[model samples]
Target: MLKYIRPYLLWTLLSPAFMLLEVFMDLLQPQLMSRIIDVGVKNSDTAYIVRTCIIMGLVALTGVVGGVGNMIFSTKASYGFAKDLRSDVYRKIQSFSFANIDNFKTGSLVTRTTNDITQIQNAFSTCIRMLIRSPFLFIGGIVMVCTISWDLALVVICAIPVLALFVWFLLTKGRPLFMGMQQKMDRVNTVMQENLAGIRVIKAFGRSDFEKQKFKTANDDLCNASLKAMRMMSLSFPAINLIMNVTMILMYTFGGKMVFNGALKPGQIMAFSNYVMQILFSLTMSSFMLMFLSRAGVSVKRVNEVLNTQPDVSDGTNRDAQVTQGMVEFKDVSFRYPNSGGDPVLRHISFTAAPGETVAILGATGSGKSTLVNLIPRLYDVSEGEILVDGINVKEYELNALRGGIGVALQESVLFTGTIDENLHWGDDSASDAVIKEAAEIAQAAPFVSRLTDGYETALGQRGVNLSGGQKQRLCIARALVKHPRILILDDSTSAVDLSTEAKIQTGLREVFGDMTVFIIAQRISSVMDADRILLLDNGEIIDTGTHNELKQRCAIYREIVSSQLGEEALKA
Candidate 1:
């Protein structure tokens, strides 16, 4: 926070400087009025009254100019600080590894970036505008009143300790509630995001009522927490006002007697009352500033949590090691999810995929098939062993260089809202339109794409909602193909396409990408039947390794899968 403030230090300092000028002008006006009443009106001196009026008018104009300057500088400093902080936070999040993202849920991160940052921004603006002005006004008012009459000033001094204690108590109690309110806000955002993303599922399953109830619960929790925090802060105003009113009554009662005794003038009593009001008003503003500070403190802590987190995966220094062959090997590799405190997802796994070879992995769900291939691209680091690409340890290669050589299409195909051409450009930004069309044709997506009115220029909805599951998968595959990476990993990416179309895609890929190493994870036996080798994974270990025929004869798990998908006669054949 201080680092960001350092850049705008001039604006920050100027705001308070001008604010002090405005407050000084404000303090002088009451004294001028007292002199006009006590000296000029009483003595019937028209020239004295006229001269003081002109001076007062000039002072008022100066105060107005000071106020405008204060507002301009404060706005610039606070808004600039927020912009810098938001950019730094977003950049930090972009650098986070999958493990770091898992630690902070998507909804929570969104809340911190948007709502939390906004809260802090508002508080900073208020601090610059009011935090400085109020304290100065309060102290200045006290000094002015004391000079007028020390006897009456003692009344304000007596009320100060009591009001200060009460305000302190309320602020202490409200801080924890404000913290809880922020957490509740995160819950509400999480529920809202989940509801929107899965609205189709909720409607399809006829569970709208269930989702509504869940949202209501989260929304109510936030409402209650917010009300509690606000309610605690509300007590500050009435308490301060009551003390202020009582002090004023005491001042009038004591000073009226002094005036009757000819010891104090009536005009001086009026000015003393006005100065007391200024002190109370400044104290009231300070109390409200404290409330804003408490909430902003919570937001500051949340933002720092993300900014301070160091990414678990850092880029390696060896940028010169290029992955030319696409040969990947895992040597006694083992991995478990961060903080899972359970068995490894892949246990002492080892395999080698030579360049240009097509290897298929077959497994039941949760068999760590995707995890095994994920290691190749260094999406995650292995817990116990080293993974090598092109005969160099993956950790030794720079992250961009390592990942750039491999193209991955995950099981859940995701697409952003953009033109089909733009989405494909993500794979190879320099690719020509002809190359993109050819990649789409190779993925068996040309037929449907050509039927659309706009063809490749068609716009997609969020997550490509306008397209069918099979269409989305084909587009993702086409995007990967456009990269023409040396290593391609398709993790059940073709599951949504029909068997015939899947076969066409496989054939096209093998024909066009024959020189690229391919790792295909699939449940369908037919998908891997023609592969150069098949790996049968059960649990976290590879149970068998061979061609389709060899696995059918040697592995019972493979035989069972074949018999289930095809008939018993077909397996016997």
Candidate 2:
């Protein structure tokens, strides 16, 4: 449709102009061949022969120029359109929420952006050049034949309906098969991506064979779908050839009689025969252009699906929701991922972190601790009730402003393949070296980092694989600290380090940032025991919240957790 092609209308039209010129030149060829046979050879007119030959040479040269021009235009249009579409798709992806992104696997999206877009580009290029050129040549050839001899043109016309039927058959059958091929490609991409990304997990579990079987199923599906499409495409050529060869035989049989009866010249018969074959060949090529079009129709549908999905999180009509003093409050908030029907990940959560106080969250694994913190940044919007950051609905504030006001450290740390300095700069690009060093010390990362050969400039492997788990965690903490955010979240940041090292990091942060709305999520009771307040969560709801001494008497869940870690005698004391 025009939606895809309108981006390149000027070149799209320009490419076809050259094709029309080429078709005119092609019509001249058959006429020139007739002149060579009748005037140049038969009568031995040497001057006439040279004059016609020169004209033919000029037309051939012009055809070559037009063909090159068409090719150049074709390339520009398709590549430029693809470039815009690629950027559009990527920008659209940026608009999506965590809930939206998690619905589709990352691998399938990569394939749609890359391989699927390429398929559409190829189809567009072919449609613009071949579709126009072949039709022009076929129609022009027929008109030229009619002028030369009406009886000869009739022989060509007789085969037109048969070619149309063959083309129609190919279109209806091949379209659905190509769509299946594209779907199969998505499955193949998913399996290959999983194998590559989880290679370490597979080896650790010794499940290489299981991964191979998954890949094989996807691969086999792709192969079968491709073969089915090719099988449908194969029907096109032989059917056209049968019609072409039959028409050629009829032309020879009919034209020979006219020649013997002194009605048509032998040279005219030869020219008419060449013209008939050209028409048939051009029709055959037109069929191929149609097949590419049908295949691309399916690809366009797939690309548009991604383009059309409205992001779950949108920057809507309401603007500039008030932000005041970095106060984060969760009141009866419940959040469930969109895929979940009504099972809340965090249920009836209630908390208030004053601008200058630190709140620690303690729970066992899968206790919805991280889910609670995610609300502050609005990564996944709450399914029921409201979450307020800075006295406004987190949804109402401009998303970047809300996210910018807070800093978060995830349970598992991540770092890009870059120098230590570059990783730190992700927190704040304008940070000075002294500030970065200060933050690193607060993370308990300075001692080991200063010993590295290049220190801040040392190259990190992909995802910072060159570093130990504890080192990576420390770097993540430094990245967050460099932000110096009003509201800071440490989601199990110390789980990777020794108890002594964690205590040191904790002291350094308190000394520097000083009770700046910190939320520490931890398994160790000692980590959160001395906070201004502690929230104890089980399942998705907060069961008890208090100072450690207060919770020891009131909350059974808190006592059980304390007893498990420090023993009943320690709790009694």
Candidate 3:
């Protein structure tokens, strides 16, 4: 946080310097008023009154200038600090691997980046202004009060400890409540995010009422938590006001007696009262600033948690290593998610995928087929064994070099809000129109894309919502194709496309990307029937590995699957 402030050090220092000027001007006001009342009025001098009045106006104008300067510099320093911190946090999140992302909820990360940073930024701005002004005013007011009438000053001095004790009590109780309030905000955001992303699903299932209730629960929790913290903080101002009012009453009682005894003049008592108010008002400002700091303290810890996290996957020392042949191998590989405390999701998975071959994977739901292919690009590291890409251990290759050579389209086809051409360019920023159209043709997406009024220039909705499911899948495949990767993994990418279109895509892959190693995960028998080899996975292990026909002949599980999808007549063949 200090490092962020350093860049704007000039502004940071200038803010407090200007605030000091304002406090000095404010402290002069009471003295001038006392002189006008005591000297000008008592002597019956009209010119003296006018002269002092003009001086007071000039003093106020100077204070205004100081206040404006303070506002300007403090705003600059605080906004700059927040910008740098937010950028670093976002960049750190981008560098996180799947494993690291799993450690935090998506909503929690969003809150940390946005709301938490905002809280700290506001607190910083308040500190720059009030932090300097309050203490100076308090001490200066005390000095001025004692100079006018030391007996009245004693009344203010006694009131100080009571105010201090009240503020301390609220701050101590308020810190934990503020922390809990922020956590509750995280929960509300999580519920809202999940609901928005899955609104269509919720509607389809007729669960809108249920989702509304769930959101209400989260929202109510946040509202209740905030009220608790606010209630505690709200007590400080009134309590301090009550104590200050009582002290003022005591001042009038004692000072009136002093005036009757000719020990103090009426003008002196008036000035003394102003100084005491100034001191107590400064204390009120201090209490509010302390509350802001307490809330910001919790925010600081939350933000630090994100910035300090070391990503589970990072670039290796072998910065120059590149994947040349698209050869991927898993040797007795086994993996379990970190902290899962359960059986490995994949076990003893050994295979070699050579260039120019298409290997298809078949499995039931949760059978680890997608997980096996994910290890190729090192999305997750093998727990008990090793994975090699182009004969080098995956951990030995630079992350960019390794991932750049592989293209992956997951079960979920995610597209951003952009023109069709822009989304395709994500795979290769410098790809030419000819290369893009050719890749689209190979993925069977060109015809539909060409029919759009804007063709490739057609703007897409979020996640390609404007496009049909099959259209979205084809575009995703086309994007991966644009990468010209040496290896491509299509993880049930064509699930939404018709059988004939899926067949055409499979044929196009063989014809256009003959030298690329391809791994296909599909539930449909027809989708993988023509592959060079098929791996049948069950319960996290490969039960059979062979060409389609060999598996049909040798594996009972394979026969059952074939019979179910292609029918008993196909199995008899």
Candidate 4:
């Protein structure tokens, strides 16, 4: 947090400097008013009164200048700090591995980046202005009040401890509630995001009532948490005012007698009252600033948790290793999610994929086929054994150099809101028009894309909602193809496409990228029927490995799957 302030040091310093000027001007005005009342009016000197009034006006103008300058510089410093902090937080999140992301969850990270950072920024802005001004005014007022009448200053002195103690009590009680409030806000945001993103599903299934209830529950929790925190803070204002009023009453009671005895003049007693109010006002401002700081303490810890976290995955020792040939091998690889603390999701998986060969993995819904392919790109590191790419251990290659050579179209077809051409550029930003169209054609996306009024320049809705499922999937495949990667992994990428279109895509892939290593994870037997080799996975282990024909001849599970999907007559053939 201090490091973010370093860049804006000039503005941070200037804000408080101007605040000091303003406080000084404020302190001067009370004395000038005392002189006008005691000397000018007492002697009936109109000239002195006019002169003092003009001087007070000039002092007010100076204070205004100071306040404006303070606002400008403080805003600059605080906003600049927030910008840098948010950028660094976002960058850190981008570097996180799958395991790291799973730990934080998407909704919680979003809240920390937005609401949490904003809380700290506002606290910083207030500190440079009010925090700097309050203490100076409080001490300055006390000194001036003492000079006017030492006896009256004693009233202010007594009230200070009571106010200080009450503020401390409220702050101490409020800290944990504020932390809990922030967590509840995260829950509300998570529910809202899920509702918006899955609105189509909710509507299609007629579950809108259920989703509404879910959001209401989260919203009510946030409201209750916020009310608890605010209720504690609200006790401060009335208690502070009561103490202030009582002290003022005591001041006038004692000072009036001093005036009657000629120990202090009436004009001096008036100045004394003004200084007492100033002192109490400063305390009130300080109380509010302390509250802000207390809440900010919680925000600071939440933000630092992200910054100080060492990513589960870091850069490898061999930072310069790049893949020349797509040769991937898994040597008895096994993995389980770090946070799950259960059996390995993938167990004893061993396979070798050579350049120019196509290997397919077939499995049940939870057979870990996708997990096996994911390790090749190091999305999640294997808990046991090793994975090698081009004969070099994957853990020894720089993450960027290793991932850059492989193009993956995941099981989920995610598309951004942009022109089709821009989305394709995500794979290879420098790819030319011809290369993009070629890739689109190979993925069987070009014909539908061409039918659009703007062709490849058609603008899409958020997450490509304007397109059909098959259309989005084909575009994802084309985006991966645009990379012209040495290796390609399509994890159920063509599930939404028709069988004929899927066949054409498979044919086009072989024609254009014959030498690229391809791994296909599919449930449909026909999808892998022509592959060079197929591995049938059951649970977390491979039950059979062979070409389609060999598996049909020797493996009972493979024969059952073939009979179910392709028919018993087709299997006999």
In angstroms, the error of model 3 at 327 is 0.7
**Each candidate's lDDT (Cα)?**
0.90, 0.86, 0.92, 0.93
The pairs that clash in candidate 3 are none
Ranking under TM-score, best-scoring first?
A: 4, 3, 1, 2
- How many backbone clashes are present in model 3? 0
The order by descending lDDT is 4, 3, 1, 2
The collision pairs in model 2 are none
Task: Return the clash pairs for model 4, or none.
Answer: none
Per-residue lDDT, model 3, residue 10, is: 96
What TM value does model 4 have? 0.98
Task: Report how far off residue 243 is in candidate 3 (Å).
Answer: 1.5
Give per-model CA RMSD.
Answer: 1.6, 1.9, 1.3, 1.2
lDDT of 3 at 373: 87
